[model samples]
Target: MSTLVKEDLFENLLESAPANFTEARQTAKDLYLKLGLPAPKEEEYKFTGITKKLEKSLSNFNQAKPLSVEENLIKESVFQGFEGDVLVFSNGKFLQEVSSTIEGLEVSDILSSSAEIGSIAKAEKDAFAALNQASFSGGISIKVPKKTKVEKPILLLSFNGANDGQVITPRFWIEVGDFSEVTFLDQSISMGEEAYFVNKVVEIKGGLNSHINYYRLQNESNQAIEVSNIETDIQSDARFTSVNISLSGDMVRNNLSLNLLGSNSEGNMYGIYLLNGKTHVDNHTNVDHTIPHAESNEMYKGIFDAQSRGVFNGKIFVRQDAQKTNAFQQNNNVLLSDDAIVNTKPQLEIWADDVKCSHGCTVGQLDEEALFYLQARGIGKVQAKGLLLYAFAGEVMEKIEEESFKNHVVGLIQDRLGSKF
Candidate 1:
């Protein structure tokens, strides 16, 4: 599990890559060697033992290869009533034939474009991001015109097919023009029964006075492992909101970072993780208030059943020049079984003299009083538990503006609880 071993493995993987990516791949290889993987001793990764999982998947790295999925599987994965333009990727390669036609947006294949796709997601400090940039086979770039408001949401579907211990890296870049509004539904799902690993990166830039809403749904197979990074930059008077829902995965780690670079910008993040069995999920969020009159808020909730484990870490930073900044963060967890474990941390670092900031975290079981009340009304024990858990998660789900999507999420949560009970 040493850095040299990983370097050699990645080097071998890159050997078959196209000649066009030689320079970028070399840069990533060097960066990976320098930064190495984050060990359990690292403060940021203290609670999550990601190195072990990485090692297990990388041991059979040579067996990793691209997989093609059936059309029926793709059709079954789509939301029933979704009216948005769909963009599909199979094993990190964009499938244009399966994607819907986009009208008001400009979309390009990142690999085919001549434009420079620099490191906008702070790859210098994030080892996984560096690896993704160095090894990503294909990706998409989206641009929204100034003053244009997209009527429909853009659905980005990344599906992983059956593969043996293979690794997939997908990259995405999004740019919102001034005074424009856009919504995106990004999802990751696995159709494979074999063990695999996915490393993905998404970078977003919001123009002045633009509005952006993003939803990330992770529904991988129980045997899959996913590590994802999302970085966003908000300009002056812009607004950005993100909702992350994690329903399934053996090991899942999400890194979300937001930079409020312009004055009067706003950012909000909400998430819910429902885990059972031995699944493990970790969420880390960082929001930076570097300018005056910016606001940021974050709320995350988790429900752990059986021997599942969950981790939440939220950090907000207010710089010396960030006067009049308003920031708030909270994390809550509910454990249904004695074996379940949760680690919650809410942090705030303020250097400004004139700023308002607060954070709080709590871990507990379902309210007995509410459970009794529901049972008294003739509801079954399992039904009562499901209702209470749904209520606990509804606080974050209410933030979803799209009614159909919210209802779909509700159904998924109910199904998960039913199976457990």
Candidate 2:
């Protein structure tokens, strides 16, 4: 109930780590202890009290050990019927490669990485990141060679399961060489019945003149609590696109940050979240234009039903040297029930005189006239509402390039919405 619990948790985690990582891990632990976890009073975490959730869910959690998952579980957890090179991780440890479709892709253990591990997603940015850097094990690093264009998507599936309480920290480091192209589907699914806390971090680096498309899907049980940090650095003349889809979870918070560190680089971000029951979902995004001749666009939309709550905070920063920069951001939400709550804030800060930037947010109910228009054409009320809601969410949903993955997401969306035809 006090700092003793936090200190004990930190010490126990340190004692459990390998001796080889003591120095760096101790540095990270000190950083975490200095800043501590996110509380309700912190402006950045005001809407989501993730620390309490982590403490309550992971206090009595069992010690993490080697875990092996059934092949069928990995098969089902992946995108159903989707064809691609699949990498599976069970309980924060790299399990195996389920399917391999491409060649010349370099894969290594997370512990095998040195300078590349914390290069982009610096642990100094936040306490959760620091904690993950200090305690994670069995993560994996992926490298795509220069001039190699992967023809198919790479599916990375991570599943977490334990007796009752669980604390799983998984890390992913991705590096792409110059003039290369690839697509990745990063997904997480819950495999346990009781409460669990999952802290995940993903770092991505884009080489010059390269193109990268990233998709993240989070589908967890009602008793799951999760926090995910995705950080990306883009080089000169490169293109990066990321789409995050959150379908189900009890308490979920996602931090997506991007830095355009070179000239003529571009970044695009899209997200969709549908929350029901007592679920809570928070999405925080940051885009920084550190150089000239760069552009970034961000858009996120969500629908809240029942007693669910949703929060979105988007920030765009244009530095003094970032001339000729163009940035835009938008956050929109629709509340389906009276008890549903949504908090959205869009911000833009530009120090460059020659830059163009804009940000806005909207929170409102479903369209009444549009619903009536559909119902007047002999369509039932529930079906008409479904049609309208689907149309509202379609703008971002249609961004998926893979047909099979899109279809799988469509099925999950329908299953969650439960609207009649």
Candidate 3:
């Protein structure tokens, strides 16, 4: 392991962090020192090659300090055709001048209102998560009061400034009160042509009878590398749903886990990734049913082209007391080119006798029979192929509840296909 702790990263930034998070940061710092960084020898990171990727991405990292950005670039980062309050963050500074406030939503950067800041995310176990906790000087916090339903989605836009070889860390904590409903859209953008690394962590808490929907769209630059972790806790009578859409990156790793702590809670996970060139992406997810009558559903699909690689590892766990639990998980992948590769693993562990659990994964090529049928119907070859691939991915897209965001995602996919299908 190399020396990853920079003097500026520790001494300068921690000075500005809120006082309430001191102990958590200290504990994370200690854990980071103890764990160093994960290598291929470690089981969790065997196929990702994250250690080498980080070493290369951070060879001359500068943290992108003293942020400076162009006006037009900020405009480009904003979500187009979306009606919502946009909260922007550049480097570590919250860009309040251009951000908007919602009526029934409480937003803060101080993080004082949250009691689960570090408790839900286990910083002691994962090195990257610990690094994020120790080095992130600022983050965003959102709260929905009891019985208050937010009509519009809240967008969190994060920008990594134009610093060569910099590291950007974005963190978030969200809480929803009982009987309330809300939606959150999270995105990250890179401004410069230089190489950079992004480390992010999100923790969400759902009160009893709460309904929450969270969406993450990732389309980072070709020179960017990232590690993201999302941890959600769902209470009794609450429902939590999360979606991840990844398009571009040099190397990316996403970790998502849901903990159903109360009976009658439900959790859903959906994801799609499109890869080309030499890019690499890995998605790891887990759902834990701790009480009786809990349910979870998960599905992830991928399209790999060129020499790119993809990996998916999903696990569903049912504890001894989690009787009457129902869990399902599946992963499907299509290789657009022979050189592309994929690794998928779907796991299920049950300790209860009266539980229904199922898991499966598939890796294959496009259906030639379907393509031939489409071509026979007067569709061009390119259009036929695009239609087949789009149809394969449309299942996950249908899970999105927001109409405008769904249309935006559809437009992105259509542009990528470059066909009149």
Cα error of candidate 3 at position 86, Å = 0.9
TM-score of 3: 0.93
Candidate 3 residue-wise lDDT at 412: 86
* Clash count for each candidate, listed in order shown: 0, 0, 0
- Which ranking of candidates, highest TM-score first? 2, 1, 3
User: Please, what are the lDDT tens digits per residue for candidate 1 over residues 6-96?
Assistant: 6666665555554555666678767877887786678888888887777775455542455675677678887877777888888777787
Put down candidate 3 lDDT per residue, 123-202, tens digits, no spaces. 97588898888777556788899998888887787777546436667678888999999998888777766777788888
Which pairs in model 3 have colliding backbones?
none
Off by over 4 Å in 3: 1-20, 66-76, 110-115, 162-165
TM-score of each: 0.95, 0.95, 0.93
User: Scored by CA lDDT, what does every candidate get?
Assistant: 0.84, 0.82, 0.82
Best-fitting candidate, measured by lDDT? Answer: 1
The candidate 1 region of ten consecutive residues with least summed lDDT is 57-66
lDDT of 3 at 156: 80
Cα error of candidate 1 at position 41, Å = 0.9
